[model samples]
Target: MTHYDGWFMLAAILAAFAANEVWRVVGVALSARLHEDSAVFSWVKMVATALVAGLVAKLVLNPTGGLALAPLWLRLGSVAFGVAAYALGRRSLALGVAAAAATLMVGTAVIAPGAPP
Candidate 1:
């Protein structure tokens, strides 16, 4: 690639990183001023939680390639099992991840026997 192309790509990545860091710094500053019990904090937490939930739903519904080739119902079922595991495991991240992985494997085996590697 040309030197200009390399510099352009570097500048793009740096810009993205700087944008994310700006949010982090703002959050840190705002957090210092706001108590956790404040209504604004609670609303922010809810919005963050909802955004995460939406992202998870999107991934489960339409995976990239590995799991996307599997049946839709299988993916949905695995996500449901994962959510249940997360709730039942007292919201433990590790246990929830394990359950989701296990369920995905089983679902893939049963639902997409001829899926390509």
Candidate 2:
């Protein structure tokens, strides 16, 4: 490849990073004045939580790559178990995440239709 091609790729990567960081810069600028008890902060928290939940739902419903190998029901069941673990484990997020991962592993081991007999 030509040297120009490398420069072009670097420029594209820089452009992508700049685009992604614009919001981060804005958030940092505004966060200094934001209070946790304020309505705006509450709204932001809600939106952020909803966005994460939506992302997780999307991954479970329409997984890509290796996750696609697991059935949707298994993924959903794992998420349910994780949530229960989170509640029962005194809100320990790590426990919840571990439970979800363990559930997925066990489900794959036991019910993988394509596994060798």
Candidate 3:
């Protein structure tokens, strides 16, 4: 509504964009010299993998919203099915996730017939 407010909002947006873009530019510059076999890259990969595993554990053990609707047994069983599918399907991450999601959906539908999706 005010003239200065519009300019302030524009400046804030530009600052946020610059803050994010700087990291991306830095990452690109750093990545050019880093080989996949380098120790630094290996460490980064390990850290990233650990973070993903932690996130998955958190989501499975303590889900919220729609996921929390299902019983704990269903959640753990779905994870078991996913891991088994992943191992049986040539270790394909996509197949494992899809199997887990499908298991969860079917289990929820069967276990809670009137539950909201």
Which numbered prediction scores highest in TM-score against the true structure?
3
How accurate locally is residue 86 in candidate 3, as Cα lDDT from 0 to 100?
100
In candidate 2, which residue pairs get closer than 3 Å at backbone N, Cα or C atoms, i.e. clash? none
For lDDT, candidate 2 versus 3, the one ahead is 3
Model 3 misplaced stretches (Cα beyond 4 Å): 1-7
Per-candidate Cα lDDT values, in order, are 0.85, 0.92, 0.94
Higher-scoring candidate on TM-score, 1 or 3: 3
The C-alpha TM-scores of every prediction are 0.73, 0.76, 0.86
RMSD to the hidden true structure, all candidates: 2.7, 3.0, 1.9
Tens-place lDDT per residue, model 1, 3-116, is 999999999999999999999999889879998899998999999999988998888787796867767787787777888999999998788878988988977777767765
Q: Compose the digit string of candidate 2's lDDT tens values, residues 23-117.
A: 89998998899999999989989999999999999999999987888898899999999999999999999999999999998888788757743
- In Å, residue 3's CA in model 3 sits off its true spot by 6.0
**Candidate 1 minimal-lDDT segment of 10 residues:** 108-117
The per-residue C-alpha lDDT of model 2 at residue 56 equals 92
The best-first sequence of candidates by TM-score reads 3, 2, 1
Candidate 1: stretches off by over 4 Å: 60-68
Task: Give the runs in model 2 whose Cα sits over 4 Å from its true position.
Answer: 19-22, 62-73, 113-117
